[model samples]
Target: MSVTAPRGFRAAGVAAGIKADGARDVAVVINDGPSRAAAAVFTRNRVKAAPVLWSEQVAKGGRVRAVLLNSGGANACTGAPGFADAHTTAERTADALGDSAAEILVCSTGLIGERLPMPELLAGVDTSVAAAARDGGLDAADAIRTTDSVAKISFRRGDGYTVGGMAKGAGMLAPALATMLAVVTTDADLTAEQCDRLLRAATAASFDRIDADGCLSTNDTVVLMASGASGTTPDEEAFAALLAEVCDDLSRQMIADAEGATKSIAIEVVRAADEDDALEAARAVARNNLFKCAMYGEDPNWGRVLAAVGTTSAAFEPDQIDVAINGVWVCRKGGVGEDRSRVDLTGRDVTVTVDLSAGGASATVWTTDLTNEYVHENSAYSS
Candidate 1:
């Protein structure tokens, strides 16, 4: 169970003939809520997708009755017609659930610079809405995959409530937001303000801490909807922690299933001047192509890590920095410590730790190793 694990929510997925193959490409999630409080985070990319632009306004209202998502056309960079398609999708969803268009949120993911198949997509909305049921979350999750090999879903049971979510991403995963689409639902009693604050905090700690290829997506969107069906008002701190755990689980799944990735790497930065400095240093290392390629080749190249960190504006001195690969201190005091050959990178997971020697603050960013297949998959993506 994912989104539908929570009470007052129903979901469904249906094939809409959007993708070349007859795969499920459209999904609908409806909140039959006593309270329809909702909040969302979208890609910060300046070249916004039509669905992102539409959902931003709906999210601003702090309430949503339903969300419709499709996974074959990004509907980005398609000019005015793209916006109209998104608007029509929302309006049709609102009509199905007896609500206003402003109360429906829309999300899309796939190739950019293309228009959505409106006829098929509108028909899909009708079918998905009609088929929505409490156990349809698995289908909904499955419908939102492009290059993903598996559907990402997570759920956590809290005191008298449940938080569940589903997400999809395979490439172009970067900072400010990954190239992804996520929908999270909860049955706990919460206000729109609380939902907004909790969603932002959870994303800052999870989704914002991952980088795959350093390419931001125009269609990235994550939404949190509260139904208030549990009749339990959870402690803000506890709920935020649960939400962060769910988001983190989905984020790791994205990296593990990243397009053509062989190794899941964690860049941990410690002893920075502040949290921001630590994040900056870690993200720089995570996005460095040389560092990623080194990991893919099973080489513990500490110099690449140091060079990447040096490009950051973080407060750190050259001689005081230390680098460790898979628990082996490969570089100490910015010089050589353990033999590079002693560092192991033979597994599917790798960890690179950097000691900034500035303060007590720390952060970790997750990423994947670059490979030849990554280049091949992306080069032929539009084909």
Candidate 2:
């Protein structure tokens, strides 16, 4: 259980035959609650998906009852008919739950530039609604996956309230949002303003720091719904901290299951002029595909790391930076320092630490290595 791990939440994932092989493609989550307060963060992509446009409105209103997600057609670039399908899905979900359609949010993922099969989608909605149960969290998590090899689920328990969430994305993973789709439910009492503020802050430190493939998804959506069933209101800072923890756990899960990734890398930028510089330097290295390939090969290539660090706007002296791979100082003062052969990357975890020596600020970004499997998996993703 993940999405339904929190009180007052029920979810279901159903096989609607949307996928050719009959994998579960539809999911439903209902906040059977005394509070319908909600908030969401969506993809910053200008050419948005139909479901994203629709859900943006729902999220803005700050109240929600049910969430319906399908993972077979992204419903992006499909224009008017796609929007119609998303609206219809929300309407059906609202009707099934005996709630207003305006309170229903819909999400879809898969191949872009294609229209969803409206008939099967609507039918799946019915099945998902009828199948919704308190124990269906895992099923819903499984249903939302596209190229992901494993389901991503996370939970954080507070004094009286608990947070539960599930995410799906293996490719098109980058900052400013990714192909990532996530749903979080909680039993805590929170106003819409608090929910919205917390979601942005939590994601900034979690999902925003991951760059698995460096490609943004038009269908990306992360939603948080509070049912207020716990009957307790924890401190705002406490709730926010727990939310960030849960988001970080889910982010790690996403990286571990990233498509065709042979290893996970943590790019840490330390001693920067400020947090912004640290973030910039870290992200620049994380998105360096050449460096990612080197990690896949277990090669200690410090030159690639320095080249990446130099591209960032972060304040740093080019000749003063130090680079470490897996705790081995491969490059010191922008020159070779340690023996390269001593740094072993045979394991799945790799860490690239860049010491700017510019200030005291630090930031960390997560990324995955590029591999043959990654190329192969994405080449046929739409098939």
Per-model clash counts, in order, read 0, 0
Writing each residue's lDDT as its tens digit, candidate 1 over 1-383 gives 99999999999989999989999999999999999999999998899999999999999999999999998888898889999999999999988878899999999987778789999999999999999999999999999988888999999999999999999996443222235899999999999999999999899999888888878889889999999999999988889989999999999999889878999999999999999999999999999999999988999999999999999999999999999999999999999999888877899999999999999999999999999888767665544
Per-candidate TM equals 0.98, 0.97
lDDT of 2 by residue, 1-383 (tens): 79998899999999998988799999999999889999999998898999999999999999999999999889998899989989999999988888898999999998888888988999999999999999999999999987677889989899899999999985433222237899998999998889999999999999989888778889989999999999988799999998999899998998887867889899999999999999999999888999988988888999999999999898988889999999999999999889999999999989999999999999999999988887766664434
Model 1 whole-model lDDT (C-alpha atoms): 0.91
| Best model per lDDT | 1
Worst 10-residue lDDT window, candidate 2: 170-179
Runs in model 1 with CA error above 4 Å? 172-178
Model 1 worst lDDT run, 10 consecutive residues: 170-179
- Per-model lDDT: 0.91, 0.90
